[model samples]
Target: MERISKTITAYDKHCDVYNDKFKEFEPYVQKIKEFIELLEPGMKVLDLGCGPGNVSRQLMLSGKEFSIEGIDLSEEMVKLARKNVPSGKFSCRDLRDISFPAESFDAILLSFCIVHLDGTEMADLLKKVAKYLKQERRLYLSFMEGKKDGFEKTSFSEEELFFYYHSLEKVQDILKDNHLSINKLTKQGYLESDGSITTDVFIFASKGN
Candidate 1:
């Protein structure tokens, strides 16, 4: 996992570029708008792996009363996020090692973030999230579709390390075994760093109320 760690560190160095490149994807904006529509006043929402606070920014600016907290593995990304969203909360930490109090949040959003982790890592993090969430709290996750253990050919700078592309069945197994319920699942186009697009998975699960 050394390569993965190194690539993440390198990404932090170019956080601005990461933000700029992703902003071009209209789908990301559309998803956030949909999320904002689901929220109500005084709800506690967490934006996990929140790169530069883009989604959180949209949520806050939507005139909703939800209390938003953002967390990311990269300190540089957190730094940039804090600059624009000084009034909101931001934490620089790994998703797998997060330290939220039990039943603390009403919702948690993991948008295209867990793709960096492998199967074991994802399962471990999901279990931890289960512990921190309320019985009825929602957990939103996004991942790439198709079967991929590693890539043979790619110019995407972030592709140097191990990454797994998971199927819907695999994600369903993870959620089921962890005692979470899939409230909704959507498959849609995800923009790649190279300006190409590919199908991806989006799931919204909830702890049984």
Candidate 2:
């Protein structure tokens, strides 16, 4: 497998404060809950790019029983995930390179992740995800939605990590191509640090034949 991408490695330099900055993001709560409510308890779940494990924490907010494991390119993020959501397992590995048995997970949560990947990477990621997910099993994604795909530099960080935006139509087509059926696609707006409102797309899909 290839080495981690430059943008992901850049995140490690700021891992010390990653949790302090993102652990408070609560917008994913309702969306995650909506997905969980449809499933039975005790299903194993994977939290891909689970920075600080905020999504894992949100999934557990309802006292629901589920097995969770998270992977991130930044080792520091894994460390914080362990501290933030002790009950869930955390690993420092790139999601693109990780392997799992077929149908290993009942559901997968990808919160505020995948925005860094363009169409090709996203397609590859979803195909790998399908291998580990059972037929009809769910996949949740949250990303910065844009009308077109491109890179944007950070406004507050010293490091020049580029954020990639993939259009909603392109993403949905990728999912379909990877044999995943879309269940829901919704958008939520939140105020950025500059007090400007930005919309994020949340998608729930099921693995298909």
Candidate 3:
């Protein structure tokens, strides 16, 4: 897990830069707002892979009156997130290894995250997360779609500390095998640095219904 450790360390050292470059905060907030509109008040929410807590802060501000927890592997990101959303709890930890009782959360937010894991690990993580979700609880996940790389083949640098381009069919099968039912799969063209566009997919899942 050296790459994972290095990626977390790089984010810890450059939280601000990562946050700025991603520009995911806006869409992240908007997505949570959309989800909150569908949720009942007083629900418990988990922001998985919540980098810097931008989406968590927005969830707090959306007037849902719900309990929320944000988690990330990068301590620096968690520290920045705590500063942003003082009312909520933020922890530095891996999503695959999150520990919570079964049926603990009403919803889990996974925005622009989860694509980092290899297929096997992703499937295992989904099963683990399913244990923590209450009945009808939602799992919102987003990914930049393309291709897959073996865990050993993936690498990252200080400036580019994450990899994407995952197959949609593989992701769907993984979730399906884990008992998380996908309600929707939205695909769009994501513009790259060289002005090229690639397809991206976002999925909304719920406990087996």
Candidate 4:
């Protein structure tokens, strides 16, 4: 996980600039509205890898009154998350270190974060998320699709950052292995901070439902 450590450090260094560059954070807003609309208020939702609290802010403004807590590997990013959405709690923590009790959360959101984890890590993390979610809870994942699994250099940042990519089939296998059944799949073009575009795959899953 040395590369993971390096990525975390790189994010900490560029947290502020990254936040500024991340101008359009509404790509998943409509899908998120639809997902949360099926649930009741006061349900706890964990925003996995919630950079700068972008998703958290949008969710709060959706009028759902969801109790959201965001966690990231970068301390500076968590700081910015707290500043960006004061209503949500933000913490700097690795996904692998999660130890929340079973059924502790009603939903989990992973956006632009799964690329940081490889196949094995993704499987393990999904298993944990499945355990934390209630019997019929949901999971939302938004990632950049890839023809193959690999890494690419940064477009805007000069910090030598690299982002991993995953194919839709690979992600589906991982979810199935972890006992999370995909309920919806949406594909669309997503613009990054540097104006480059990539295919975005949004997957909504439930407890093997």
Candidate 5:
């Protein structure tokens, strides 16, 4: 819990820096567009760990009218998200406490934030996400790929942030357990702010009716 708190604090303290670094970056634009293509116009979408609303902004920029609601653990990030994506609703909320109604969202975006959750917490969160997603809807997830979890410092902040790296097989099993069928899974190299390269795992899954 302490590590999580510290990670949130770091984000709160460096929200501006993080936003500046990522706001215009669109390395995953193609993947996001593919996910968007699966949905119809005027659909309800939820963005967890929305981080200054970058992904939400991309969704909006796709020229589709989506009712987007976004949440982040950092109040500062929520504030920025509201400003950046004024058409969308933004809130400060922990991922572990998400409590939206079952089958409420047409699509859910969880970008790279699952890196903070361990296996058990990740499973619980995926279950909740699956419940909130309407049947036949999509869920997008991205995370740093690895076999271990720990705290690490990034260029954005001096404070060390907790990171959880789940292997592809582990994530696959968890998605299966939650009844989310994988539609697409890909790995791409991402250059970190600290000048290190990390493998990023992206997954697009759909729920069965």
Candidate 6:
């Protein structure tokens, strides 16, 4: 818990830098567009760990009228999200505490947020995601690919943030266990601000009606 708190504090302190660095990043824009194509205008969408509203902004820019609800652990990030995507609702909330009715969202994005959660927590989150996502709706997930989990300092901050890495097979099993069928899975290399390269995994899954 201490590590998680420190990570959130780091984000709160460096929200601007984070936003500036990622607000225009477009490595995953194609995947994002694919997710957007699955939804119609006026559909309800939830974005977990929506840093600076980047994904929400992209959705809005796609010219679709999506009802977006975004939540982040950092208060500053939430503030930026609200400012950046005024049409969307933003809140500072823990991912574990997310409460909504079953099948509440037409589409959900868990973008690189599960990196903070351990294996058990990740499984629990998938369960909640499955419950909140409407039938035949899509869920997008992005994360670094690996087998180990630990704390590491990034170029943006000296604070050590806990990162949990899961292999493709593990994530596949978890999603299946939670009743989310994989529609597409892709991996790409990402150049972090620290000048290091990391293999990132992107998954698009859907629930069965």
The C-alpha stretches of model 1 lying farther than 4 A from their native spots are: 151-162, 191-197
Tell me which of candidates 3 and 4 scores higher on lDDT: 4
Q: Kindly report which residue stretches of model 3 are placed more than 4 angstroms away from their true locations once superposed.
A: 21-25, 148-158
TM-score head-to-head 2 vs 5, winner: 5
Which pairs clash in model 1?
none
At residue 29, candidate 4 shows an lDDT of: 69
TM-scores for all candidates: the values are 0.87, 0.86, 0.87, 0.88, 0.95, 0.94
Q: Candidate 5, clashing residue pairs?
A: none
Instruction: In model 6, state the lDDT of residue 97.
Output: 83
Better of 3 and 5 by TM-score: 5
Distance (Å) between predicted and true CA of 161, model 3? Answer: 1.6
lDDT of 3 by residue, 1-209 (tens): 76677567677777886666553545545666776776778889998888888778777787777798998888889998898789888898878777889999998888766767766777777787788899877888887776444232211223445555567788788778878899877777765555666676777899876
Q: Give stretches of model 6 more than 4 Å off.
A: 193-196
Q: lDDT winner among the candidates?
A: 5
Question: Candidate 5: lDDT over CA atoms?
Answer: 0.88
Over 110-156, each residue of candidate 5 has an lDDT whose tens digit, in order, gives 99888998888888999899999999999999888854578888877
Q: Show the colliding residue pairs in model 4.
A: none
Ranking by lDDT: 5, 6, 4, 2, 1, 3
| Clashes (N, CA, C under 3 Å) per candidate | 0, 0, 1, 0, 0, 0
**C-alpha root-mean-square deviation, candidate 3:** 3.1
Which residue window of length 10 is worst by lDDT in model 6?
146-155
What digit string (tens of lDDT, one per residue) describes model 1 on residues 59-175?
A: 777887678899887788899889867767998887878777888888888887777777788888888778777877778888887755664223334435445676778778878
lDDT of each residue in 1-209, candidate 2, tens digit only: 22235566667777665566666646666777788886678889999999878888876665777899999877877888898888999998866678999999999888876876656777788788878899888898888865344433343345646566777788888788778888888998867666677788998899883
Q: Name the weakest run of 10 consecutive residues (lDDT summed) in model 2.
A: 147-156
